[model samples]
Target chain A: MNIRPLGDRVVIKKLEAQEKTKSGIVLPTQAKEQPQMAEVVAVGPGGLVEGKEVKMEVEVGNKVIFAKYAGTEVKYDGIEYTILKQNDILAIVE
Target chain B: MNIRPLGDRVVIKKLEAQEKTKSGIVLPTQAKEQPQMAEVVAVGPGGLVEGKEVKMEVEVGNKVIFAKYAGTEVKYDGIEYTILKQNDILAIVE
Candidate 1:
């Protein structure tokens, strides 16, 4: 299934978090939380500011760090996706 | 208490959620979660994009609606605050 964001919102696919510690210790499911890292897959054209269109700074394929609890979660094609506004993005990893 | 945001981060104080319905019906505590509304109190000077500084679009006193789960929670002077990037802000209430 294809999903498109509305306005300045972006669709992201989260990166899986490590299940084991660096010391090779495995963590239980209840002990781990959803990951905060994601890859930008789709983005809105831009948002309106005072009736003028403002383009987004981040683009598709950017790896971003977002807040753990941000965005609305949705499932498409058996994959989990997140829809978040551009402002919800914190930083783009180089 | 005084708090300063780092980089393009902004600090917001959450608006209280209505405990009772408009019809005067009250919801139970377990049914209620933290409010998603907030007012911008402090903002970072700006963030660097491609070596250029960009100013924030929203200003202090702007009431905004953020995602149900966004921002890092912090406490200062016995008050709770959320620290989020400028992009996390969805819209400014007029």
Candidate 2:
């Protein structure tokens, strides 16, 4: 399913978390935390401030690091999508 | 301890979660989720685009809503702080 964000929001598809620990120990799903990495899919045109349009810095296909607990989670066609503001993005991976 | 972020990062202090549920039942800490509300304590001087300096849109003391899982967690002087990029912020409360 296609999803689009309104305003300065963006839609991200989270990367899957590692199933094994650094020590090579396997962890159960309940023991695993949400992944903090995501790929930018769709982004809003930009944010508005004082009736002026502010353009976005990040673009589609950028791999970004974000907070573990940021964004609203939604399920569409059995796929999960995150809606986050532009500022929530921590860094863009080159 | 005072903490300031470098670059386009911002420091946020998470608001305390409600101790009681809407039904007035007390929930255990394990069952409680992290609070999504925060106050912006500091912000970076905008982000660099192609080596050009950009100014920030938000300022200190802005009550902002961010993604539930964005930012890096740090502890200093027995207090917790989150370092997030300017884009991670969803909205500023007026």
Candidate 3:
């Protein structure tokens, strides 16, 4: 991974969706929603916006939760990833 | 109008959707998608997360573009607004 996102953007590896319930019942493909959790892979250096300098909050390897339907999906080497701005991240998962 | 969002959260007033299309065609109600543009009303101070302090890039009154279906909707004083984290904002419209 030799890529850096431009200004306020982030690169993330989306976590795989769960396929089973609490009772261990396998769910159908349509029964699960798109995964909203991911691992931060790379981050962009914050830049100027309206004369204010921004800073990044997340770091590489942080597990994060992001907005559903946010970010663009990018496929590299047959692995899927997402790229979005830092603002789309809701929280860092512990 | 006295709402202050907590930590990395933002308050935005959604821009109304256009009712007509190009060439003077009137779009029906069901044909319009939810608005993804907004005016920033308030911003939260970036906070400590994983030993890093995030910084806010956007200010009040900025026209911003965000992901559709990203934020939580709220109605106050008969006006609709959205509350989302900074990561949900894609760009600031100049």
Query: Per-residue lDDT tens digits of candidate 3, residues A1-94?
Result: 6444546788898776562232243324452443367889888777643234668999999978787577765444456666687889988866
Per-structure clash totals for the candidates: 6, 21, 6
Ranking by TM-score: 3, 2, 1
Candidate models: Cα lDDT each: 0.65, 0.63, 0.67
Model 1 earns a TM-score of 0.45
Q: Candidate 3, residues B3-79: lDDT per residue as tens digits? A: 89887789999765441121122212331233255789989886753445556767998866566678799988998
Which sections of candidate 1 miss by over 4 Å? A19-35, A49-53, B1-94
TM-score of each: 0.45, 0.46, 0.46
Q: Which wins on lDDT, candidate 1 or candidate 2?
A: 1
Q: Cα deviation of A64 in candidate 2 (Å)?
A: 0.9
**Candidate 3, TM-score vs. the true structure?**
0.46
Locate the minimum summed-lDDT window of 10 residues in model 1 chain B: B19-28
Query: For every model in order, what is the iRMS?
Result: 11.5, 10.6, 12.5
Question: What is the per-residue lDDT of model 1 for residues A15-36, given as tens digits with 9 covering 90 to 100?
Answer: 6654122212221233123225
The regions of model 3 sitting more than 4 angstroms off are A1-7, A10-94, B19-35, B49-52
- Please give the range of 10 consecutive residues that has the lowest summed lDDT in model 3 chain B: B19-28
Error of 3 at A50 (Å): 20
Put down candidate 2 lDDT per residue, A63-88, tens digits, no spaces.
Answer: 66565567899887888889987667
